[model samples]
Target: MQTYPTGVAAKATGTPLTTLQRYLQRSHITLQPCDVPSRGCGENRGYSQRRIIQIALTTELARLGIGPSRAAKAAFEFSDKGNTGRPVGELYPLGQTLLVGLPDGKSVVINIPPDKSISDVLSNDSAAFICDCGYVVAKVLSNLSKS
Candidate 1:
């Protein structure tokens, strides 16, 4: 498995290094370590690509109002809900995108269709505000589609 240094993960995920480190220290995530030699000539710790992606995804989700803890739990639930073998991308239009910023000083652009029902688009445990956004958007789209 590929691993990413703290900096690389921070850049890729649009998260600040300090925040990432705090999350790591809090045991909010498990990261894969890199194999590169330590630049400080001391103990080196690295993070895995999987962990980086998870962090990035979680961060992005939180920006959409899903708290970290709840986001983690929802991820597992969503994965299981999709066990019917249908890809999520296939279920929703891929081109619809949204730009979001997290409280942790991270920003990301994600693709999420305007057509998906609010209930289908967000995790059950998602923040109430997140569901509200989906509901508001869905209503707007429904009106537009009827025209």
Candidate 2:
């Protein structure tokens, strides 16, 4: 598992460096290795593959008008602990149209069966943000490969 610095991670995740920095500063994004003085601050400021996925998720959240802090927290939770019984990272590179319900400024990812249609997923939601996990991961993986 290769680790990328902030710049490379931002590029890989399709997030602007400044935006990523802001997320980090706001504690929306927490460095995996933990950027602490004991571990050589600069040396530990790295993002792993999972982190890239988390960042990409944040980008998708932002597209849905989610604020930086909320988006970061939601993305990190979805990517790290998952929302649909599994981490969103597990769906990486797969063409899964994740139906993320956005109600009252809350981000909740609903589990949609493979046989279900978008209409089925949105049957009860007031607002939904579909995250094309495949597309997002493709962009990130493509950018990462370029490194």
Candidate 3:
């Protein structure tokens, strides 16, 4: 797996460094220790390609006026829901509502809006909001793994 330093990751994701650091602090996003040998007591950590993609997605979510708390959860959920071994960017154009695939092969459809919270969308009992993205992200990720 390719790893990126914080600076490089911030640049790659087009996120401000401080915002990225805040995301790292608030989210359960996985990170790895830098593989390079260090001479000092403190060793540098690195972000994997996975983490970089997550940051990029989170940045996009933030651009939609979503705060870090929800954005973090969304990022994690998107990653989990789209997991098929492909790059995370393959999951773009997430429909208004996302149908998350569960581990048991079942799915949970989540309705989302810029003005409403995710919890609020879930609590709304309207069938009109229920729809799937056709698992397009998942398929893209799967194809990426095959290649």
TM-score of each prediction: 0.47, 0.76, 0.51
Ranking by TM-score: 2, 3, 1
Per residue, candidate 1 scores C-alpha lDDT tens digits across 1-147 of: 444566766666667788777766776654324334346876566655435445665565667766676553343222222323334212223434332333444432333555665346443424233222233234333533343
Model 2, 111-137: lDDT tens digits are: 566776767767867764556566676
Of 1 and 2, the candidate ahead on TM-score is 2
* Model 3 bad stretches (over 4 Å): 28-42, 80-147
Q: Number of clashes in every candidate structure?
A: 3, 0, 0
What tens-digit string does per-residue lDDT give for candidate 3 at 27-143? 544553422323466766666655665566567656756565655555555544454433333443343546443333333435455567655765644322222333433433353
lDDT of 2 at 58: 87
User: How far off is residue 99 in model 3, in Å?
Assistant: 8.4
Between the candidate structures 1 and 3, which one is better when assessed by lDDT? 3
What's the C-alpha lDDT at position 97 in model 1? 31
TM-score of 3: 0.51
Inter-residue clash pairs, candidate 1: 32-47, 32-48, 33-46
User: Residue 34 in model 2: shift from native, Å?
Assistant: 8.4
lDDT leaderboard ranking = 2, 3, 1
